[model samples]
Target chain A: MKILITIQENNVAPRFDLTSEVLIADCRDRQIIGIPRTILMTRPSSEELCGLIIKENISRVVCGGIEESHLQYLVWKKIEVLDAIIGPYLESLEKAKEGTLKTGTILPGAKKIRSMK
Target chain B: MKPVSFATCNNFPVTEILNGVPHGVAILDRDLHVMEMNRFLEVLTGFANADARGVHADFILRSNIGNNEKLFRNVIETEEYLSISGDIISRHHKKIPVHFTVSPLKNESGDPAGLLVFIEDISALQCFDKKRHNMACLDKILGHSPKMQEMFELLPVLAHTDATVLITGETGTGKDMIAEAIHNASKRSRYPFIKVNCGALPESLLESELFGHVRGAFTGAVKDKPGLFRMAQDGTIFLTEIGDLPLTLQVKLLSVLDDMEFFPVGGGKKVRVNVRIIAATHRSLRVLVKKGEFREDLFYRLNVLRLHLPVLREREGDIRLLLDFFMREFSTGLHKSIKGYTPKALNILTAYAYPGNVRELRNIVEYAVNICQGAKIQKEGLPRYLFIPVEEKPPTSADERRDEYSEKAMPALDLPAEIGEKTVSGSWQDVEKEMIVEALKQTGGNRSRSAKILGWGRTTLWRKLNRHGLA
Candidate 1:
């Protein structure tokens, strides 16, 4: 199975339409197959991303704050969507792997701290 | 300073006080973890306080706060407050504009304990600003006069229908702008809006340009060309200067209006289109019909819905308003600090009849803004032709003075050495090119600043620059 997650830096992007980076992971039997592929788009466009999902044969999508029209389109294409989920992408990915990821899930955990350049 | 513990302070319900505040309030520990949040914060963020507690605030309130560790550390070290305006995404995926105030919280021994953050929703204020901006300029047509106000009210009513529209006005009175505004307000706005100028092209080319031509239709026709009517399918086709359309093309136009179909030049088959027709002219089509210059049936068909734009000179109380508007716009665009016009300058501007209407007024303001060095626009900054003799009192009635000048009853105006027209030479295009070149020279080839100096937007300047081979 293939899954796509929209991300900004390390955390899930707040809006799907404004996300310019996406991670695609190929999994089998609810376990990881290899390292996830990170794709960086030249610009943020939900329509282009939707087309990318179909072209890549993605079966599942995890994102934050997706509009209803896009959600319906993905559903129409037989792709499962877990949206309105916020937190670090790593934790979200883990939950998705474990089959515990739910819509509108706000993951709670310690945050990464780093100094400014 | 000794830190007073809130728990030690008896008879005070700190949580209640925090919850009673109007703004969203949240308490975060030094690790940038959400320790507690009030009811308002929960409602604003669309997350329950219980669920948000202990989670990183970045996840709960997804804002532009990059690297929370560094930001919180800076606030802790500096012991200073920071306020910023940004947007946050709620749990329901709704983006809300908000202002945030973050302050450091201290414990005993003057050690940093946590942070206190306040969030204020600003969407209502933003909505009000947007409403005010739309009120000032409706579809880029600015006028506060009662007649213009009535026309503004009628535009939407006309746009809702698919009736053929005819816009009549003098040159430079913004007839094209009215047609565009109607098209923009209509459902067909989602499609293309193709504009064709009947006067700009010759007769044979004009017909082919409107209805297109097939391969080998004319001697120069090399390929099949989809005409403007076909290109504007499911949209609007604006015919400007319709009075200039020749009698031959008028019959073809009338048939298209009646049947929504037309045959390409030399094409046997008729091409059907679903385009809306919007025709504009500066001359009276009725008068043209009587003169045998225009077809009466076509004129009547095109005039199903008529809109006549009043000249700027006749729009009462609008001259001063437009002058002030242009003055401020040019001042800001030119990066000048001009506040207003001097009384003498204002008198001359208001008394002069704007023969070229609003477009001319805008140009004059741009010219004045470029020359005026002081905060107020002085009389010397105005065009030389607008200046009456210093000894003569300014005219009290613009119409009467305009008529006197038209009848040649007024004395021949003395040509000043600094006459504005003398600075440029040749036809209107030549003068415009000279002005653009001069503006570019004045701004040292800075396109943005040159555009401001010429009272035009950057894209307009860019297109003109390319057209004149200056780019």
Candidate 2:
């Protein structure tokens, strides 16, 4: 099964000194290794994220922060969503690999962040 | 010193350290007035040094991290320091966890005043806490033997996987406990842990119990009953003693496990579920499959992640522990004040091979305690069979021939027997009396919960004392 983990945009490649974007540390138990897929920093709609999730053939999604409307949208889309995190981008990736991330909060703005100020 | 520029309004610029350099810095005074706010603070808070002047950190910082005014107060009141890690979503709704430390601030005279707060985004703490919490739940499970330990090690790894698990063990060997432990440790722990005992009820009942039933499906059709599978949607269900499941039900179970959906009994609508199956069996399902007692297809599906429980006899050292454990357990309920078991009795108990295992030993202990007189359980209190030697020389060939010719089960012991025996009967009291006497012989007159487990109320249990002429 392919699992997609979302970290802060700043964590991609040379921006952060991570050995790998997808955490393989705990993959032995899952008998699975994650495939790293990057989503640009611009705020995206839940439907848009769902499209991406489908494109990536994502069975599970892990991200640091998810807003309420988008969370509902993901719920409607039958896409699992989790928010609420404290850590560097890679830390969240490791936790996601271990299957221990918790329910994140509903972000102030739901699907749209342009007017979120 | 580097340009120590300050903004008069912001509270802490520590969050800037998480970035390339100190991007923001602010200082607060005794009345929580902004003493100094750096240029970095102005850019991040979206306030110029002039506009940010004299502003309180509370209004400027709107997040769980900024809400630690109480911890700040504690620092001021006790002249101590406090640090906490928590979540913070910025005005733009970019959520993250940060570490905050507050220390009592001193004036030019070194007198205590307000405080200096430092905030560093440490969302990593939340992730680490989560993993630690998961491990904590795993540690609650009992058992330390190699097999159990191996499974314990495997559980955390397995819990991460979305795989079907199979647990095998004897009755009351805590197979259900193992299933629960696994579920509790899994990613789906937040969801339900539904359980089904395949052997408890017959096929029709078991079917309805598993897949649910529509109202008016059968004779007891008073109301609609939701099946366990539906109840366990997006969760895990433990199917115990799966070998006892009828072949037809096995096929159905296999179908649902394969498809994640099933039709409710007598209901036209089909309910699709997202659930994991963790099955357990005491019987060798393989043997049953070969014997045509179990469905081969279903057996293979449920046997994926196999767990085996070792017999209690194999771990005899646990016997002494279990005995001491059950001793206190039975003593309280049986209301018998047993000081302890004699070494000789313990020897006899330890020497006997427990074919029935722990549960049987529990039954034996409960049975023996009732007949125990003093605080100590002596040899006389045990069943006579435990002490009898198997190799006794019987009468010659002619006598053995006559005994063999006898048709009764025990040949009625044509020769005189050693012990005194009498049969008694009477009123309801007599019936109770006879039953108690027999049970006492069965359990050795242990008038405790063990006796109650045998189905006699305590008072009726003691009636055996009077009837047996031992009172």
The lDDT of model 2 is 0.60
lDDT tens digits by residue: candidate 1, B1-471: 122354233676565777889999988877777777889888888888777777767667766555555776678789998888888777665678899889998877678887888999899999887645533335568788898998999988888899999998766778888887787778787799899999999999998999999999989899999999999999999999998899999999999999999999999999999999999987778878998999999999999999999888788888899999999999999999999998767776776667567887898899999899889997657775554332334653333444554553432323333443443233446656877887888889999998876667999999999998999
Q: Which structure among the candidates has the greatest TM-score?
A: 1
Which prediction has the highest lDDT against the true structure? 1
- After superposition, which runs of candidate 2 have C-alpha atoms over 4 Å from their true positions? A1-117, B1-26, B36-52, B58-79, B84-99, B105-114, B120-137, B185-187, B220-226, B259-263, B267-272, B311-471
lDDT of 2 by residue, B1-471 (tens): 111223221654533432334534455655554555555444444344454445445433334543345556667788888777664444333455556666786654666666766666555667787767756645544445565566777777767777898887665566777777777778788899999888899998899999999999999879999989989887899888787888889888888989888889999998899898999877778878888998888888887887777766566376676666677778878888887799757776766655455676787788778777679876556655443333333433322423432332121211112121221122345434554555667667566743554454677546656666655
Per-candidate iRMS values, in order, are 4.2, 14.3
Measured with C-alpha atoms, the lDDT of residue B416 in candidate 1 is 35
lDDT of 1 by residue, A14-115 (tens): 678778999999989989899999999888888999999999999989998766678889999999999878677889888898889999887763234221
**True-vs-predicted CA distance for residue B92, candidate 2, Å:** 7.4
Task: Judge candidate 1 at residue A40 and give its lDDT.
Answer: 97
